[model samples]
Structures are given as structure tokens and as C-alpha cells.
Target: MIQYFRFLIISLLFVSCTDETATAEFAKGADVSWLPQMEATGYEFKDEEGNKADVLQLLKDRGMNSVRLRVFVNPSSDPRSGHCSQEETVDLALRAKEMGMDVMINFHYSDSWADPGKQHKPEAWEDLSFKELKEKVYEHTFEVVSAVKAGGVTPKWVQVGNEIPGGMLWPEGSTDNWDQLGQLLNAGYEATKAVDDNIQVIIHVDEGDNNEKFVHFYDNASEQQVKYDIIGLSYYPYWVEKDYTETIDNLAFNLKDMVKRYDKDVMIVEVGGLYDQVENTKNLLEATIKAVRDVPDNRGLGVMYWEPQGEKSWSGYSLSAWQEDGTPSPALDAFKN
Candidate 1:
């Protein structure tokens, strides 16, 4: 009996240690979902030495160890506006992985952008009943995740929806109908796990500083038994039109509260500052990373710049960290050390 108990104890310890090792690595990187379209349209990427190279290599050389790619449902081929379709997303994921970086797959569930302001159900899904809608959600999620995994890299994180503060899929899947919204979210979770049970699922919301928003959504999620493994947040000072210093403390507080209250890991999955304010943006990035690292128990998993490589000149996104002359802003150096 003593020998049998010893064997069992060793087995249990091995299992526990393995789980910890699986998630022990910290992720820091950017989302360059627009790279394919950007390169195709002649946006040259140069490294610090002014030598043109793959943008992923430049990013990896600058303290990034992971990559986040956004996947849209059925996207148009518009070079500037659209084209994050599954094929594009999968190709990017493979490139990042080939560069020895971990991957995070973000699902928008829309043909275009999906945020708090808009969560348009895919045009194909607009007419389906709520029950059918859930099925489509599962089918779509499973197909995409399976394709990504089959492409030689299993994503470490998969966001069910991007910045979904108002709930996803609208009308029926809106926050106004928690029961149906919960079901829709669960469809995503179930389908994701069906593909790879180990991939962590994230329920992302914008406004990391607003503990009230997290409490409200997560509270209802808990009540509805929404199956998710992480709380993903997006913090943008530019959008709020305020200095990050104003809410940095609140963001830190929310990170601490989330881990303890939700009993799950958290990640500042999206964060970026304006390109013009290099110093302020660098300080904000450093402070934001420090806040996540300060979370007790290592529940803070990662920080990803929304689109650091999407330079303003080419992408017209003012918050990018790339210079018009094809170089990264010093702000990205915050990830170092």
C-alpha cells in the first residue's frame, strides 16, 4: 500500500507540473493582421539597420515572442479595408510560428470590424434563428481553428470575439438577453475545445480601466456558466482622448481584482498609444506591462500591440508604432527588459 500511494503521488505531481509548464511562458508581441495586404500594396518594412526584411523578423528581434492575428468571417479583398479572412489569418499565423513565436487567434465573427459600437452578425448569419445561429457559430469556429492547427502551429490563445463589451451577434446575442448571449458564447467555447482542449479561450472587452464593465459582464457570464479560461482586455488612451496616467492605476486595480474575483487568468490582449507621442507612448507601454506583471500569482498572461506594424502612412491608423520611413518607433522598446 505504501508503494502504491507513492506512485500515485508522483503521478499527480507530474500532471500538476505539466499544466504549469504549459502556461509558464509569458507572451509579449503585436498584432500585424494587415501585413499581407500592406506588403502586397508595396509597404516596405525595414529593420533598425535600414535593411529591408520580413516584418515578423523585425518584430521578433525587438523583444516580441508571440503574434496575434485577427480572423474575420467572410471578408472582401479590399487591400486597405478588408481581407483578414481565414486564409489570410492562417498564413500569417504560420509565418509568425515559423519565426519561433507563439500565436493568438482573434475571431471577429463579422465580415468587418467587431467592437462595442458594432457587432454585425455575418451577412450569411443575419437571417438564421438564434438556435441556428449558435450552430453556425460552432461550425465556423471549429472549421477555422482546425485549419489553423492543421497548418503546423496550435494557437496558445483564441479570442471568441474582439472587444465585445455589448455582447456579440446583436439583437438575440446582445447583453440585453444574457441567456441567449451566454448560449452563443458557449457555442464558441465548446467548438474551440472541440478542436484543441488545451487552447485557452478569451472573452475580450475594451476599457481595461473600468472594473465596473468587467464585473457586469463577467458576473452575468458566471451566472450563465459561460465557459472561458481568460479575461482579455483592450486599453487605448488615444480612443479615450486622455493620458494613460489617468487610468493606469484603475487598470492595475482591475487586473488584480479580475484574477481574484473571476478565479481565472487575465491578459491585456490589446494596448497601443499614438505614434506622434513617442515618449508618452513608451511610458504608457512600460507602465501597462508593469501593471500586468504586478498581478499576483502570474495570472497576467500577455500584452499585444493592436497593430504596431500598421504604419500610419500605409494603414492610416494613427496609433501604430511604425515610422513612415519604415522603422519601428522607440515606443516598442518598452517590451525589452
Candidate 2:
């Protein structure tokens, strides 16, 4: 009985710490999952003084208090499109934590990019039966999560699957089959909690400005008994080819609506603007951060820039916040406040 009471006290303390973190920190950072690969290729990051610097430290100095890292199964070596294996992600998470930054682990459940457009299962998972698929989901999630903790950093949040509004693991776990999707999601959720109930689970989707998308997905997820602690979103104005001014209002409204309707904290887990439009991007980020901070009860968790350190020259991706000269763009200063 004494041991049981002692355990209960520790458990409650852990839960309390998790809640305090959500209310205390407004997560502001980038999904710099490609940092390891970029550094391996000899790309250097510079501070404002043009002196070589560690990008993580530069981001922290700019007011970022968190980092989001994505994990893949057996991945390819492509710097832009592949190689976020568990080991790589765990290492990155350790680095971020060592720098006093909170970490979010994103499970893509695929060997490549998994988004609203496509969610291909990893090659090893493709042929499994539905039952086997769910087990794999749990197993994979558990392993990576346990590994991250063992590496000395417990991720504050774990996204069950990336941009999964249409569902993940393909036909068996697609939106067309919400029941199956829910089960698969719960498998990931359960796995996450099995590692540590203190870790919050996130369900991510794209098109943050589209309220209909949120309603359609979350409504169905609710009916299907999908369990989650947070709603994660990806908002990229450059991808939509529109100036952020056009949809910033909608995004703000959606943020409030999701919190009220679902009673869950919400986060702009991924967002970015064109590297060339630094001023406009800065404005967009400032507005985005304000919108989140304005949410009642602070249910609006935070906003994270996707790949802000990914230089366009090296990534061939134009939406990063890094300048061509290898310095971080002023746009990142939005987090300065």
C-alpha cells in the first residue's frame, strides 16, 4: 500500500508537469528535421554577425523555445525527401533538449513524406493485414518514443501521424473508413501513453485556414472515437500561392473554433512563407503568434515554422526562413518578442 501511494504521487506530479508546460510555453520554433542531413553535406549556418553558428542556438537566441522533429521508418538517403530515421530523430531531439528547448516528435508512419495528399505506409508495413498494421503502428510508435526518452529527452508532444486528415496507412486506415482510422490512431495514441502518459498526443492536418476541413475531419474523428489531446495544423501560404493576409483571419477563427468545439489545445505545428518575402513572412508569423496567444485559457498552444533553417539553395524549397548567404532571415525575428 505504501508503494502504491508513492507511485500515485509520482504519477500525479508527472501529469501536473505536462499540463503546466502547455499553459506556460507558447511553442515557437521550426521543424528543422533536415538539419542533420544539411550539416552532413557541409552547409554552414551563420549568425547575424556572419560568424559560423549552430542553427539551433541561433533559433533559440531568436526566441524559439521548442523544436519539432519528424521520424521515418527505413528511409532513403535523399537530403530533401528522406532520412529521418528513428536514430536521427532521437539524436536531434537530444540536441534540442540539451539546448533547453521543448521537443515534439512527429511520426510520419511512412518512409517518405506523409501529408493530406498522400500517406503511403512504410514498405515493411504495406503488406500487413489490418490487424497487423495496427500492431505495427503501436510497435513503431512505442519503440521510437521509448528510444527518445532513453536518449534523455521526453518529447512534450507526439503526433500520431503527420497531416493525417485523409487518414494514414492507406485504404485500410483512410478517412473513407473512419472506424479503422480511429483504431489505427488509437493504436498510436495508446503506444504513446504506454511509454509515458505525460506525453500529449497530437492529431495533425493541413489547410489551417479551412474551417470546413477541420469540422469534417474532427467531427468524423469524434464519432469514430479518435482520442487526442491536441490538434496540429500545417499552414503554408506559399504552398497555396496566396499572400497570408488573405487567410490569416480564417486561420485565427479556426484556431478559436477548434479550441471551443473540441476542448483541446491547438497548435500551428507547421507553417512557412517564401524565403524571398522576408518582410511579409515576418508579418505573417507575428500575426500567427498573436492569434494563438489570444486564445482564451491559452488553449492555443503555439506555432512552429516548417524548415525555417532549410536554405532554398540547398533544399530547392523556397519557403524556408533562411537567407541565401546562410544567415537566418529577419522573418524569424517574429518570435523575438
Q: Which candidate tops lDDT? A: 2
The digit string of per-residue lDDT tens for model 1 on 218-245 reads 9999999999999999999778878999
Per-residue error (Å), model 1, residue 312: 0.4
lDDT of 2 by residue, 219-337 (tens): 99999889899999889877777888999998999999999999999999999888998899999999989988888988888899999999989999888899988999999999998
Report lDDT (CA) for all predictions: 0.91, 0.93
TM-score of each: 0.94, 0.93
Question: Which regions in candidate 1 have their CA more than 4 angstroms from the true location?
Answer: 1-23
Candidate 1 global Cα RMSD: 3.5
Residue pairs with backbone atoms closer than 3 Å in model 2 (clashes): none
lDDT minimum window of 10 residues, candidate 2: 21-30
